[model samples]
Target: MNNKAFEVLQKEAPEVSEVWQQFLLKASALDEKTQNLVYLSVLSAFHLENRIPFHVKMAKMHGATRDEVISAVLVGLPALGNIVTTALSVAIEAFDKD
Candidate 1:
């Protein structure tokens, strides 16, 4: 079942998806309990194209502070540049569900 899932993903995005899959697997070295920050950071970076609410919920479930999540979004500013960061900020606000 999982192999089928992976095959589908690889077929859909061979190069980028493979890199992401490997990166995620490598992240396991940090331990699940302590990886919330890392996950939240990536979640923020992927916010424009990914499921923001889902990741936000996961971050909350992992005991992440709202500030921590916002900081994650802010951290993307340098790498993503101002415009992309602004787009991500909008996603963050939407995810806040407030």
Candidate 2:
């Protein structure tokens, strides 16, 4: 039988699973919209993860403007530097959607 995504994650790494749950709880402590914007910023960090589109959509749903999301991504550029930050261009492409 195919396990659900959550189940697979739990089995794969129980420690990570706990941290994930805790992260979600903290994110959810904010308003739904703010939470979504935060998630979008995170996904923007992992361009190849294929999670960018979903989180960008969620960010929009949460009332974040394109500028806000882009700014958030840009905020990481200093710390992540060019090499890592450039990878997040995929998020800009994703955000270009209608």
Which candidate number has the best TM-score? 2
Model 2, 14-98: lDDT tens per residue?
A: 9998998688767576876677666665655554336666667767777878887777666656666664465356666777786
The lDDT values for all models are: 0.61, 0.66
How much does candidate 2 score in TM-score?
0.59
Encode model 1's per-residue lDDT on 1-98: one tens digit a residue: 24466678889979977899669868687744246556556655655434455556666676766777677667767886664465455446645775
Top model number, lDDT:
2
TM-score, every prediction: 0.51, 0.59
Clashes in predicted model 2: 0
